[model samples]
Each structure stands twice: as structure tokens, then as C-alpha cells.
Target: MMILGLVRWMQPVHGYDVRRELLSWGADKWANVQPGSIYHALRKLTEEGLIRAVATEQVGARPARTTYEVTPVGEDEFQTLLRGFWWGLSEPLDPFSAAFGFLPALPRSEAAAALRNRANLLRANVASMRASLESDWIRNSKPVHVGWMFELWAARAEAELSWCEQVADRVESGVSYLPAELENAEGWSAWREGGAPLDADPE
Candidate 1:
């Protein structure tokens, strides 16, 4: 999606230039761009008749480079990709699932505190990233709606904060995520027999 928009914004650009522009706009840090993927996408786009080479030029210190422009078909393809990107929604893919699965070991009060702390951290991050997202670098960029990406990010951050608060409340109220077996003695021996450890301390 970015490549399409970028090529449309700056036609007659090389893969390296695309990479450089993306880096300048901090796409690697914020978006799903990989520096190495630009050339590959360019090749694929050319093969798919989305973009066509227009000229070759040699700068003083840089190697000769082939420039590309979006074809008319590429404009249509770009809109397709852009619309698909904007309309698509996905569930959160958090990396903390594994740690959360083992979270029963902590006492309820401790867990609540930790969750609250996480909520605060996420709030701070949301605030900071929002400031940057609203900065000229993003707002002045193409599409005028680029800031919408960060707006969605902020919304997710707000959702996460709410989830953290809810989870903290649940932990504090003793309505934890622990399974019934972990909360009862009958579950222990059976769980042990199933080769899972009964070392879980549902404090």
C-alpha cells in the first residue's frame, strides 16, 4: 500500500530512493516496511505491470539507477491495495500471551498492580506517539489521511488501557483468569496425571 502511494506521489523513483524516503518518514519504525523488501516489491510490481521503468541516471557518488513510474493500471491497483488496507481489520496480536499464560504464579494484588502499571505505560506511550503522529512529518505527508493510521493506533492503545483496567479489577476482585482446576484441589492431581505440573500457586 505504501509503495503504491509512494510511487504515485513520487514517480520516477528508484528502489533505493523509495527506501530512503520511507526511512526519512520513519516507516520502518512505524509501518510494516522492511528496507530489503523495497527492491523485491519493485520487481514484483514491474512483473505485474503496475510500475514501468522510465529512465536510468547516474549521480556523482551513487551507482547508476533505473527509475520507475506507476502505470495507469498501477493507479487502479494502488487504490485496490489502499482500500483493502484501510478496510481490513484484525484482532490484536500481542507478544505477551506466553507470559500472560504463566501469570497465575503472581499474587492477585501483585498482578493487579502490574496490570495497572502496564496501563499507565501504555497511556504514556500513546500520548507520546500521538504527539509525533500529529507532527508535520505525518500530517504534511501524502493522502492527508496518513494520520488516520496513527489515530487507529491511538484507539487501539485506548482499548488496551481499558482492557488492562478491566483485568486489574478482575484480579483484585478475585475473578481471575485461572482455570477452575487451579482454583480447586480436585484439579491438582488430575492435572499432574496429565503430565502438566501442579506447581501452579493460585495465590
Candidate 2:
């Protein structure tokens, strides 16, 4: 959907330009836009008849580059995807959420320390985002909505940081999870020793 939208917005654009534009917009960081997959995605979209190659240019000694423009079908699909995402509130899956389910497997001190480390990382990310949003280039050259994207990302990081800190504090000060006996079972001891992952449904 993102690639289709970008192609529609910047018609007659090359895959290199599209990839660069997405990276410039920090889409790779926030969205599922992988730099390596952009070219493949363009080819796939062309194959699917959603985008058509309008021109191919070759500079001597360099690979040929094809320019693309979205089709009417692509435009309609992009609009449908955009509207669906806007009207929905689906949350991205976080690995932390899955790990949190087995929180009792770790000692309280280790869990608290890990959460603190995560909080620190989030703090750094938030600071970097704020710095970018305040940069002269962002303010003068980028669209106003780009700043809003940074704000949204920073706000989410801040919220998660707060939650991490709160959880760390509670864990450090003692919060009930599983019964002590179960937590210290032979299986849990093996997991800690072997660093084994839990099954979706452990017997």
C-alpha cells in the first residue's frame, strides 16, 4: 500500500528515487518499508498491472533504471488501503508483549534491569526524533505532515518509556505474577539455564 501510494504521489519516478524518498521520509524506520525490497516490490507491482513502466534510462556503465507511474486501479487500491488504515486502530505486534507473558521466568532484578535498559533506548529514540523534528531542514523543506509523523512516533516512544519505568519500579519493589512454587518449577529452572523459548501452549 505504501509503495503504491508513493508511486501515485510521485508518478514517473524511478525505483531508486522511490527507495531514496522512502528512506528520506524515515519510512524504513517506522513502516515496514525495507530498502532491499523496494526494487522487488516495484517489479511485482508492475507484474500485477498496478504500476506500469513508462521509461527506461541507462547511463553508460550503469544499470538501466525504469520509471513507473501508477495505474487507475492502483490509485483506487491505494485510496481503499489509506481509508482502511485511517479508520482502523490495529496495533503493530511487539516482541516485548510476547516476552512479557513469561516475565516470571526471569528474576525480578534481571527483569527490572532489562526494562530499564529498554526505557533508556526508547529515551534515546525519542530524543533523536525530537531533534529531527526541530531541525531547520525538516521545518523548511519537508511537508508539515512529516513533522506530525515524527511527533506521533515520539509520543508513542514516550508513552512506552513511561510504562517501562513504571513496570520496572513495580518489579523492583515486588509485584505478584505467578505463585512462587510454580515460578521455581524444574521447567522454569531449565528454561533459565538453557534460555529456551516457551511453546505457544505449554503442557
Candidate 3:
């Protein structure tokens, strides 16, 4: 997604230039963009007719580079992806976590079943991330910054799995709903206290 964004930002950029910009953005610290994946995405986009490749001549010993430009189709797709990314970040809680938090709104048996299902899904995701983090492709030749990002993602996945287990335990123990009084007045008060202040009346 970042690569696509970069391509859109710099209309005629080559693969090497894209790699350089990734480093410039401190992507190594905050993002994971393997060399192969970068090349692969560019190739895939070209093949899909989403981007056009133009050959540029070099002056010195450097070989000519193939610069890429996003097509109209690519621009529309990029905007769609960007909107989804922003929406996911702005949500107060992840969908998976939110389901667990509001399990009381569901029937006792059904909620318990749903909690177990989500826990299994989370556990599988954690294991998959761990395996990817430990793979030779990621550990050996990949840059330290990129590897660190994988590690960070794996850590977050593990933490989420732990939370899922805790929720499961609560569900299994027959703790179904927050008390009506607590759900109403207390919950509303706590929510208002933590939220941003309301705007003053307009003069």
C-alpha cells in the first residue's frame, strides 16, 4: 500500500528509487517492505494494467531504468485502499475485540461459542505470524528494521490472543452481562469523563 502511495506521489519513479524513498520514509522502522515484495507489487501492477512502465535512458555507467506511472484505474483503487486503512485506524476497537467486549448482548451459550471461535482464529493468526517471523527469508537477508516490524506485529498478535483467552474464560464462567445500572449510568459517566470536552456554546 505504501509503495502504491509512493508511486502515486512520484508519477515516474523506478524500482530502485522506490526502495530509496522507502528508506527515506523510515519505513524500515515502521513498515515491512521486502525487496522481493516491492518488485513483485510493481510487476503485478504493471501486469494488471494499473500502471505503465516507461524506459528512461541513463547518462553514465548506470543502466537505463523502467519508471512507472499510475493509470486512472490505479488511482481509483489506491483511494479505496487508503479510505479503508483510515477507517480501520479510527475505529475505537477492532471488530474482533469489540465482539468479545459485547458478548453479554448475546445469548449465554451462543456468546460462549463465539468467543471460542474467535480465540481459535486469533491463536492461528499468532502462530502464522510467528512462523513468518522465524522464516529464513525474513531472518537472514532481510534488513534489521524490516525484521523488527515483523517481530512487532507478532508481539501485537500474541497480546491480542491473550486478551481473547481472558474473554473466553469470563464467558465460560457464566458472567454474561454488565448490571443494568452499571451499563446505564456508570458506563455513561465513565465514557463521558474519558471523552473529549464538548464545544462551548457559540457566541
Candidate 4:
């Protein structure tokens, strides 16, 4: 979305220049966009006829560079992608949710261990994110919205880290989960015996 909008707004920018602009704008920290992905997106958008190469220029010893300009179709697609992401209350479909749903397949001890490991990793990541936000590079270079984005990601990481600790404690303490039946046991007994998952009812 940012790529398309940038092309449209900037008008006939080279791939390298676009990426430099994006970096200056701190899209990596804010939009999670990598520099390589921006080039890929430009090539893909060109192939899709959303953006077109307008000119190729060779300046001095530098190799020929292609400058891209947005087409009418690109403008329409940009608007669609932009409008799709709105500020409103909506459930984000996270892949973590799926893994969490399937967590019962593992033994309680294994699950607790895994959750504790995850908590440790999240703690490290949250600390790194907070540090980056505080660093002069991000604080000075990024826009106010980019700062908000970092704050949001850091907050989410912290929350998830806390949840991991809580869930691990619950599993370790045996505070949650239903009474077990002979049909299902933790780890791979239920799967090996061709039954439902450990938490699932045979009925």
C-alpha cells in the first residue's frame, strides 16, 4: 500500500530511490517492510500493470536504472489496499491463535516448557524493540506514526510475553484443563492410537 501510494505521489521514481525514501521514512520499523521486498513489489507491480517503467537512464559509471510511474490501474489498486486497512475494531486473524488451539496435542509439561521458552524470547524481543524505539536512529528518523507503530508492537509483545508466563504457570500448577479419560493422554498417545487430540472428547 505504501509502495503504490509512494509511486503515485512521487511520480517516476527508480527502485533504489524508492527504497532509500522508504528507509528514510522508516518503513521497516513501522510497516515491517524490508528493503528487498520493496524491489520485489516494484517488479511485481510492473508485471501486474499497476506500475510501468517510464524511463531508463545511465548516469556516468552507474548502471542503467529504470524509473517507474503509476498507472490508472495502480491508483485504483492502491486505494483498495488503503481502504482495506481502516482504523476500527476488527479481530486480527493471527497464526499464533491456530498454534495455541493445537497446543493441547503436546503433554502439559512440554507445553509449559514451550510457553516458558516463548516467554523468555518475547522478553528479549520486547526489550530490543523498546531499546530501538529509544535509540537516536529510530527516535529522530521515524515519523510520529512510526513511533506509534513501534509502541503498538512493543505493547503487543509485552502482553503476549505476560500471557505466556501465565499460561505456563497454569499448566505447570495444573490449575486448568479437564479431567482425563483413558482414551486420550498427553503428547502422542491420542494421535498414535488414532483418537482425537488430548483435550478433545471421544464423543
Using all chains and alpha carbons, the TM-scores for the candidates as numbered come to 0.72, 0.80, 0.48, 0.75
| Candidate 4 local lDDT, 96-186, one digit each (tens) | 7898776656777788888899989988988888897888877787456666677888899899989999998877775435445633545
Provide C-alpha RMSD values for all models, in order. 4.8, 4.7, 12.5, 5.0
Highest-lDDT candidate: 2
lDDT of 3 by residue, 1-203 (tens): 78888898888999888887776545755556765678788989889877889776686988777899999988988999999986876534457666555444455556666667766787787687678667775665434556676677678767866776776676667552545555455334422222212432211
Tally clashes: model 1. 0
lDDT of residue 76 for candidate 1: 96
Candidate 4 overall lDDT versus native: 0.79
Name the 10 consecutive residues with the lowest summed lDDT in model 1: 189-198
What lDDT is obtained when candidate 3 is compared to the true structure? Answer: 0.68
Q: Residue 36 in candidate 4 has what lDDT?
A: 84
Model 1 — TM-score against the truth? 0.72
In candidate 1, how many Å is residue 145 off? 2.6
lDDT of each: 0.77, 0.84, 0.68, 0.79
Candidate 3: segments with Cα more than 4 A from true spot: 4-93, 97-102, 180-203
Off by over 4 Å in 4: 24-34, 87-96, 179-203
**Positional deviation of residue 4's Cα in model 3 after best superposition, in angstroms:** 8.2
TM-score-wise, the better of 2 and 3 is 2
